[model samples]
Target: MIAIGFEGSANKIGVGIIKHTPDGKVEVLANVRHTYITPPGQGFLPRDTAVHHRAHVIPLTKQALEKASLKPSDVDCICFTKGPGMGAPLVSVAIAARTLSLLWGKPLVAVNHCIGHIEMGRMITGAKNPVVLYVSGGNTQVIAYAEHRYRIFGETIDIAVGNCLDRFARILNLPNDPSPGYNIEQGAKRGKKFFELPYAVKGMDVSFSGILSYIETLSTTHLKTGKCTAEDLCFSLQETVFAMLVEITERAMAHIGSSEVLIVGGVGCNERLQDMMGKMVAQRGGYLFATDERFCIDNGLMIAQAGILMFKTGHVTPLEDTWCTQRYRTDEVLVTWR
Candidate 1:
């Protein structure tokens, strides 16, 4: 079955086409994305991000179809991210998906954003039923598959880890052309000092609001007083926060008796975080599965992969029930396909 997916959860909008071959292999025919970049020291707002999606979704859809060498008539269904994202951006992509569903006479499959990341990570790395650590700008959760759902073993109590990094980037006036987190990672590479920062790990769960607030205060005084360089701050921030993530993830794995771990979501693309996770998982005599920006960051193909799996399992969103949401949880969806 052939499927096309639309994703516009945050600053980036993406469209992808994929096919589930008769032999059971999935083929990614096309995957493309356009980012809504903000100026340094700025963060993307929902309204602005929605505008970006509305402006680019059509062109991006055309590009995806062309790259796949397929027509709308050839696709079996239309898939889209339903939620756990910004309200406006989610609605924007949902409307596009609904429109295409009606125009092409295709069924609509609404996918959970986090599940998309999990399914794509599993497909790319061939990691079956591994403990998942989903880290993104909007979310942070340590999950494990059990029964009929992706169970969240741990998560953030406040802001997500990626949001913490992005906010730090804004304080440092880092460019957001590619991504604030990417720039922070690059800066951290050049850092020579490990400035101290708050570490808030609450058992299985973690928190970043305290760390961000403390770092913001430090940036105000430390940067001017030469107590620490931006690189040092970035380095310290990554080390501290990633350590918290690694700690929680490892704890989750231990609790669930899981040997294998999979890292998903946009922040999972960070080399430093991957390295930290790799070392931890290695010590436990297990494997760590990760992907590059192509699949790691928010993209349409992940949505397609997850949606098509659900579609094959006789799951389809009715036209009236195609509404988007901003509060969908990873454990909310029944994992019937699994």
Candidate 2:
């Protein structure tokens, strides 16, 4: 069976086609993504981001289909990221998916954004029942499979880790060509000093709002006094925050008694973060699983891969129930496929 997935939950618009065989093999026929990059020192607005998705969805869908060497009629299902994202962007992509479903007479599947990341990670890495650390601009959670559902072990109490990094990048007027986080990572590579920053990790949950606030103040002070370079700030921020993430991940791994760790979501692509996590898992004599930017970052393939699993289990979203939301929790979805 072939599935076409659409993803525009945030600033990225992606289209992917996947083919699943009866023997339980999955092939990524095509996975195309285009990001809506804003100017330096600026963040994306929902309205404008929605417009970007609306304008690019058709072209991206066409490219994906072409790359897959399949037509819309050949697709068995249309899958899309339905919630836990920017409302406008989600709706824009949903409209496209709904239209395609109607136009091609295919089934529609509404996928949770977070679950898509997890499922894709599992599929790509073949990490069966491992502790998952999902981090993105809007979300940060440590999850594990239990009782036929992906349960949250821990999450952010305030702003997400990726949001903190992006906001800090804005303060530094970093280029958003690839991504704010990517630029921050590059700057961090040049850093030599380690500045003391607040590290907030309370039990299983973590908080980044206080850390972000403190970092912003430090950035302003540095601008006036030149006491610290931007590279050092980036380095310190990454070290402090990623260490907190690794600490919580280790705690979760210990609690679950599972040595395997899988990191998903956009922030999962950071090399430094991965290095930190790898060391932590290695110290425990465990293994760490991670995917490259194509699968780690927001993409239609993950959505398609996850949606196909739901479709195979006889799940379908009716047109009337296709309204998009911005707060769909990961643990809310029932794991029928598992």
Candidate 3:
């Protein structure tokens, strides 16, 4: 089946086309991502993001279709992110999917942004039952699949990991809209020592709000005292947060008897996190899989891959289920595959 996917959940705009044959694995015919950092003054431009989707995704969609040797009419389904993202951007992608589905007489599949991440991780890593660590701006959770369903073992009690980084960036007057993680990574690289930051761990569930608060206080107090550089603070912050994740992931792995570790979502692209998790997984003789930014940072290909799986299993959303919301539980959707 031929499918087209639209992703505008965040600052990035992406369009991907792919097809799967009964006897062969799914193939990515074309995958393209357009990013808008939105400069330093603005946090995020809602109108600009939508315009970006309209201007970039439409053209890229056409190109992807052509590259796949198919016309828009040949597409069997149009997949789009349904929720757990900025409403403005999701609206843009949803509208685009609706228009295309209507124009081409194809099914519109409302793919959950988080599910897309997990699906893409599974497809890329070939992990049947791996421990999943999902870290992104809008989400932070450790997951596993059992009894044909994805289950959340642990998650953020308050702010997400990426949001913590973004808020820290905002305080430092650094660019945040595209990715605060990148700037923090660079800042950490320039750092000389490991400073102390809050490590808030309440059992398996982690809380980043405390970490954000602690970091902000550190920056303010250090500035008043004239003692530390932003680079040191950034390094310390990443170390504290990533250490928390590594600890929790290791605990989850031990609890669930899972040796394979798969990291997904936007924050999964962080090289430091990957290295940390890689070390922990290796010590236990486990395999670690992290998607590259091409797939890790959110894109249409993951959604398309998810749609194909849902289609194969006859799991579909009715037009009534087409409605989008900023909040939806992963467990709310009935699981048909592990």
Candidate 4:
């Protein structure tokens, strides 16, 4: 099956094309993305991001098809992220997908954004039924597949880790061109000292709002006093938060009796987090799976991968039901194929 996907749930807009073969082989024909970057200390607003998506979705789609060396007639279905994202940005991409569906006369498959991340992570890492640690700008959860759903074992009680990192970057006036988190990671590499930050882990859940607030004040006071550099703060924050994530993930693994862990989402691209996770997994004599920025960050190909799986199972979204939402849950979709 050939699927073309559109994703614009956040500041980035992406278009990707992929094919699933009869022999169960998957091929990524094209994956193209464009990000809407804001100035330092500024977060991307939904309105501006929606405008960015509207401006680039068409060109990116064309680029994807051209890279795939295929026409619209060759695509089997039109796939799009249906929800759990910024409302206006989600709607902007959905409108494009809907129009393409109508124009190309292809069936529509609405995929849950979180499912896209999980499915793509599984496929990329070839980790069979591993504990999943999904960390993105908007979400943070430890999950496992059970029965017909991906059950959430643990999650952030307040803001997500990525949000915390991004907000911290804003406080430091770091550049957001590639991503504020990436810039923070670079600074973290130069950090030689680690400051103790609040580590909040409540059973299987975690919290970051307090940590972010605390660090923000520390950055303000310490930077002015020349007591701590930005790198020190970044390093400290990464270590503290990643340790929290690793702790919860390890707890989830112990509960589920799983030896393998797969990391997915935008924040998963951070090498520091991956390193910390690897150490914990190694100590447990288990394996850790992770992807680089190309797959880890929000992109359309992951949506295509999950959408094709749904389409293969005879799933289709009626035109009337092709709506976008901002609060879809990970366990909401029934995993019939699994």
Please identify model 2 stretches exceeding 4 Å from their true place.
Answer: none
* Model 3: CA > 4 A from native: 45-48, 176-178, 224-226
Q: Which stretches of candidate 4 lie over 4 Å from their true place?
A: none
Of the two candidates 2 and 3, the one with more favorable lDDT, higher being better, is: 2
TM-score of each: 0.99, 0.99, 0.94, 0.99
Clashes (N, CA, C under 3 Å) per candidate: 0, 0, 0, 0
On the 0 to 100 scale, the lDDT of residue 3 in model 2 is 91
Question: What does candidate 3's lDDT look like per residue over 1-338, in tens digits?
Answer: 87788888877888888889878777888888888776653466677777777778787887787777877767888888887788788888888888777777788888878888988898888887899999998899998887766788899999899988877887887876457788888898898877777788889899999888888998899956868898888899999999999998999999989999999998899998999999999999999998898899989998898877787677666766677788866655556654
Poorest 10 consecutive residues of model 3 by lDDT? 329-338
In candidate 4, what are the lDDT values of residues 36-107, reduced to their tens digit?
Answer: 998898999999999999999999999999999999999999999998999999999999999999999999
lDDT of model 1 at residue 231? 95
Descending-lDDT candidate ranking: 4, 2, 1, 3
Candidate 3's C-alpha lDDT?
0.84
Report the lDDT of model 1 for residue 3. Answer: 89
Candidate 1 C-alpha error for residue 71, in Å: 0.9
- Global CA lDDT computed for model 2: 0.95
Per-residue lDDT of 40 in model 4 = 90
lDDT of 2 by residue, 209-306 (tens): 99999989998998579898999999999999999999999999999899899999999999999999999999999999999999999999999999
